[model samples]
Target: MRKGLPILLALMMASTAVGARAESIGHADLARLNETVGAIGRRLADTDARKSDASALLTGRLAGIGAKGQWQVPTFDTLAGKPTLHTIPVDFMLAQLRLQTGGKFAPNAHKAIANGAAPALFIRGGVMSLDELAKLAATQHPGAIEQRGQSFIAHWPIVIWSDAGLVLSAGQQLELSTGEGAFVLNSGLFTIDRASLSSTPEKNAILPEFRPFLATAMTGAVQAREARFSNLGYGETGVTSGLSIVGAALYPAKMRSSFSDSSFVGLNAVSLENARDIAIVGNRFQKMVGPAIAMSGVTNSQILGNVMMGTRMAQAIDVQNRTSDIEITGNVVLNNRGSGIFIANDARDVTIEANLLSGNGRGGVSVVRSACIDISDNVIVSNAQVGIKIRASDALSLSGNDLIANAGAGISVLDQQKGALISVADNAFSANKSGLYGGAASEVALNANDFAGQSPILLDGEFAAYVPELLRMSSSPEGAPQAFTIHPNAKSTTGQTSRPDCKTGS
Candidate 1:
């Protein structure tokens, strides 16, 4: 201060001289302005120092925890029924569990521990019981937490009473050994990876019905990968109202009943009813008694990149009961007892694309009483019945597909009701019994398709009127046999033969 006083005095004199030349200005205002600027500079410097200290503290804490090679549990004095705020790392709480339980944790707990580092959580702490803390830890981490020696064996169902979260991390396993199913009463989120859930088989006369591994009536997301479900009756996984099931694997019992029971027929691998905004992606469904994936009254959903095989008595994927706006893409459906993909019961606005459907007992794709469907870019072959079958459907577009070696027609249209419009374009058909079969009342637009090695475009009943148009739109390679062949009984409504020479008739 003493050294700067002379310069400050000179500056003040200069300001006074300037003020005299101008209107009468005071020196006190200049002094106050200088002081305020100095104060602000000091405050900013302090703030930066504080921020540096905070950063150092966080770095040191993380380093210290790593150096210890074991978690250090924080000590907290209990305040019953009093709410307290805590800013703590989730690992600290997990460490506390290890301390309380003497390091004896379940396999799933260990999996939760290894999935990833725990996040620092700011929680409103209260009188949290151990159970509540376990659940919190499980939710914050990515694995399930189980109490020590808690047997899942029970005759009645295991019901989650309130809002909850369960997770099973990679390399973790959880088997629910129950005669009955598990249920979630309230909303929940379940994340599972590489886990198994199953039921113990009951003796004769005590067979369980509708005993799925996990069933929920609440709204949530079930995100699983490499998860397994087996030995459960009805469906292995089920959701009644709301949920998205993504990336799961489901298998039936090793030895299941063969009585052809209806309860077992309609429900098996995965069941969804009255669900919306759902997505089933990248799952494997194998050897199930009923449909691998069954939905009713569902809408606005996507089923993508899944594989379903060896279905016992139902379609690989079944959509029924007015489900609408569904997109099924890039799936492989093979060796099912019924149709590879079944769309029925007024389902509308559906798209099936880029799929491989083969070796199914029924048609590769079956549409019954549905409307506004688009099927494209699929390889449908070696099915016991037609490659693609449409019955009582309207506004169908079948394009850019490969239909080959099916036991029945490449494309079969039957019982086409009024107002139906079928469009066939850019498809390659080979070695099927018949390339296209049209039944009564079928109005077809055939365009730019390749037909080879079989009878192509067979029309029955009222469909004969479209023969000239179908012939004009279809073609075969040069030096190959003529592609279009008409049945002897085929007659146009204008009383003309089914010939290319015939004129187009209404």
Candidate 2:
């Protein structure tokens, strides 16, 4: 009994601790929760009332319709008797959806309806609910109707089989859910002119798998794909190429505080994969987790007139894997975790021009294993690492760029593959720890750069054969020998000394 007393005391203490950790809801908190729940239920009731009113209005509008009419709204009992088909204008179906969902169509949708660009459908006669009718309409057309909270948002991704295309005019709003949005696949001439596409934050927080707002894919034969003047938010992605996104504001999710770290790859503002002739112009990409724009295996793409900022954990623009002929111009890329622009892995024929890249955690630009890159006319400044780091690449032309106030070397060219040709001409380098550092087998064509009041160019590795040329070009325009310096690891050539300055015999 004495030994068992300790065990019994321990069990009692454990139970007391467990009870102490348990929390009970206060009466006020419970009351608040009840009130919130009641409010939600009341809101739902109001929505149902609105739906009923709209349905009554629609029924009154179609009351005098007789049999064999093109616009027929048969009663549920009438539809149950025989299998009848009715042809209705697409806009009428949209109107029915608006009545059912208690939502409004975008102005672009109205304009399309007015212009007769909206398609007509032959709906089968059946006793179906409003949701059923919406599903049926979506199946017949290349669009979707999604139920979001008290509103059901409609999307019309018109399929262009011929020369005539679909156009979404200004002041339109579209809501999407998981696996439901607009897609232009194998279509031609798709255009969105000043519209808004959004995913409801309430729905997105509840539904984990959300799709993009707009996408174009496998459109090799398309004439054009363009989106201009739009506000898009709370989607997996705003756009996917092959298309041009111009003058748009793209957000990862609805404007909320919780989405600051929500930079999932699927939620990129623009994602381009295996795309050609793509253009992203005059756009804003902000508060995203992954890259603001990601291009993979793309060709002939241009990123112009864009502002990319406040990305969570990635670059503003990431180009990877065989992407060629890309021009990144007239853009502002700032305050990102990774490099502002990262070009890597077999990308070629790329140009970075006339951009402001600053305040990034990593370097402004990083090039790895790519060739034929032209870095010109850019202000690269105040980054965590080197302004530009080129690794294992060839055929680089670095001209007319301002490399300033960086944490590391302004320009670092390291581990050059054999027979690589690098050209440095007409650039300004200032206020960096080191202006330039060239490593093994760097065949640099150095000419006419302004390096006054900057650190000397540090050359490393073996340069026995090219030492004379290096010394000759090391002098400034005023003929001073301190502009270029050789690293200690550099091998001594004939008639040369191991000195920091590039002077005669030293």
Candidate 3:
């Protein structure tokens, strides 16, 4: 009996260590951090940095060669041979630090992934209900599942551990039983199809730490279709990854992820970082606290057929960090506190077309430090700032767009003297405070643009118009709305129609 007891203990240890070795985003960083902490002890360690303050540290970055910011680690993605400059997230660093100092570090994702849902709940997935899943898991891990009629509750905070896949779908209701309850995807497939993840009683109302959220990491893939996330996320670290997918950009492009026909209500924006080949379509974003969709280092993806409304203090769509080859089209972004679309950080080869951008607090589209961007065939109206503001960019072509009645200039090209290439043609501008600002008229080649029957409306009004000091005129530019045509059926989610005649709509 004594010999058998040792054998039993060995089996238990093996089970606990099943996925001890896995791939994680910051496992190597965590190792190096430990070494630094040991050697340096207190010196040079940002001791005040905590897991809760991750988002605040994201702002510390500098551009150009040989400029050191606060970051100590090299970035995962490289540009042409130069290492990308970015700060290691403070909260993420703090998350690992706490684990090491007092607890255990989060293990890397398990190497082998099962084909379907969580192995404990699903033998082989063909779509099962929560009741069946809880029953099956109860036999192995007792008290893990609690039931209340149609809703099932998890005994603890849900972590789809490195080796696991969780597919919650088919009218299932998995309530976040605790305020700190969350669903973390670590190198696995997390699918929420026709299912819901919600803290119905609103845990945030009581314990602020009870923020329920969904975060994916370590090359994890998310497939959410017709799913709903409510009362789920906060803007701080440890819980900030609200409906987020932070993938490795250099990872195989064939590994596709998608979020379509879903709904995010009263949550932090959907964030995608270092992700590739994703499709975000037919989603409804409502009353988000910040940018409805925040993307960084993402490539070869499409943001289409989505309706983003009532974003607070940020653009509806914010793309940054050299994210190239993306298409932001067929989306209705309006009434946001910031710009409609904001792009920056040398991001290139983007198409912003067939979108209805109106009533934004900032520019309809703002591009900075990006290149090879095309903005066309959209209604940019009633925006608080310029319809399209370009700075420190190259190869920007703005054609086939209607810029009307904006509080600021229709087009503001701030860096044309700095060798930025902007070619504007076949666009209609009406009632803009300034048609064009900055850029020299001599620098533009106007042979391609027809300058027939044009009206000079660049702040030449008697009632004191609002215009920037500088103006860039294109050989008495043409108001040729006829040259451009949009799809006849283009309409926003609120059923607001986009004008196909290239004319201003009431």
Candidate 4:
């Protein structure tokens, strides 16, 4: 008897499945759908109904509950330009949009509205909903113009433009216009990491800029007025690096507290470590505590055409630790307390060219433990230390430089550096200590220079001094102190006993 019951239950289940599948929408069903739609249109509408209400009819037809407990939503393909007034409900419309366009409401809006009747809205059964009719109306209606009064309001986690409305995400071609009007973002704080919004004169598109703040961690600073803690991150480690505050200009006095308040002047430490293809150009870095650009363990970096000035305590450009193939050119560095440019700690294949450095307290340029560095066409002036310093380096070349007013040697090489082997040609040195100094270096070549300083430039250490005759300085008048003696009171005497030769192997 139990086996018989099992067989009967299986037969009954099969019959139910077949009946459900075989059931089809009937002509009566269609008639009822039409009637329900008409009734919906008349319910909330006045007798002198505007033509816009026709959208309700469309919503009702698409909102029918099927026999299988499934709901059907209308799509553009289903409408096919039929002219009956269809009122799409809001729920159906939002659902349709969410389904069809993947949350992009702008693209398909016009077509959806034009092809349907007046869209409808309802509040029933403890639920607020939109009929297909309302969807059609809203889609067809012109988008609201951005209102000026409500441009920036606090909207937790973000301060959005009142005019921009509710946007899940902005498209690539996003451009915000604050023309003749002011827009303020005052969300207490907001983030713009990797989201671009540019309204400058250059381009007119949404999201013109790619990375306003391209990082994960942020605190204060966006609209932090009178706030104590404010910071941004720009480290490549994907952890907190506190460098997104690099180029942001701020005033310390305006902040709420003076705990660690400082104004933004230049780039903080940028983590280009082990990263490749870095290019820094056309930036104005002023009064920064860190290097204008710091790259280490990186490859194929190009730092060019930047203005670095008034740094607090570091070099303008600091490259270190096995970096290679870097090109630094056409930059202006001024008034740094440290080196204008420094390449040290095993960097190789670096090219420093066409830079203008002046008023540096320390060495204008310094390269240590580096190889294949080409220094050319630079104007170094008024630095307290040597114009260029090379140590523990190899295959270095210096040419076409104007080293002026340096307190130390025009170009100094030490510790077996290949500076002497490099092509030192067509360089001009005026009022420098020693035009060129070499120590223990091999294979140096000095050719076609314009050395204008004290006569008989000194070379120290075990160097095979080539072109020592060419190292002669420009003429000085009777008592001009022969290249402005290191101490103003002292003078260079002519006698052999007075002249102590401080050459490498004297």
Top TM-score: which candidate number? 3
Off by over 4 Å in 3: 1-129, 140-143, 161-163, 204-210, 236-239, 249-254, 439-456, 459-506
Q: How many backbone collisions does model 2 have? A: 2
The estimated TM-scores of all candidates read: 0.58, 0.55, 0.63, 0.45
**Clash pairs (backbone) in predicted model 3:** 22-109, 54-91, 179-210
Model 4 regions more than 4 Å off: 1-241, 244-267, 417-420, 453-506
Candidate 2 per-residue lDDT over residues 82-134, each given as its tens digit? 22223345455445433432342111223322224544423232323334435
In candidate 1 the C-alpha lDDT for residue 170 amounts to 45
N/CA/C clash count, model 3:
3
Clashing pairs in 1: 143-167, 144-167
**lDDT, model 3:** 0.54
Model 3 weakest 10-residue run by lDDT: 60-69
Report residue 103 deviation for candidate 2 (angstroms).
Answer: 37
Q: What is the C-alpha RMSD of each candidate to the true structure, in Å?
A: 29.8, 23.9, 25.0, 34.9
lDDT (C-alpha) at residue 233 in model 1: 44
- In terms of lDDT, the best-performing candidate is 3
Supply candidate 3's per-residue lDDT for 64. Answer: 11
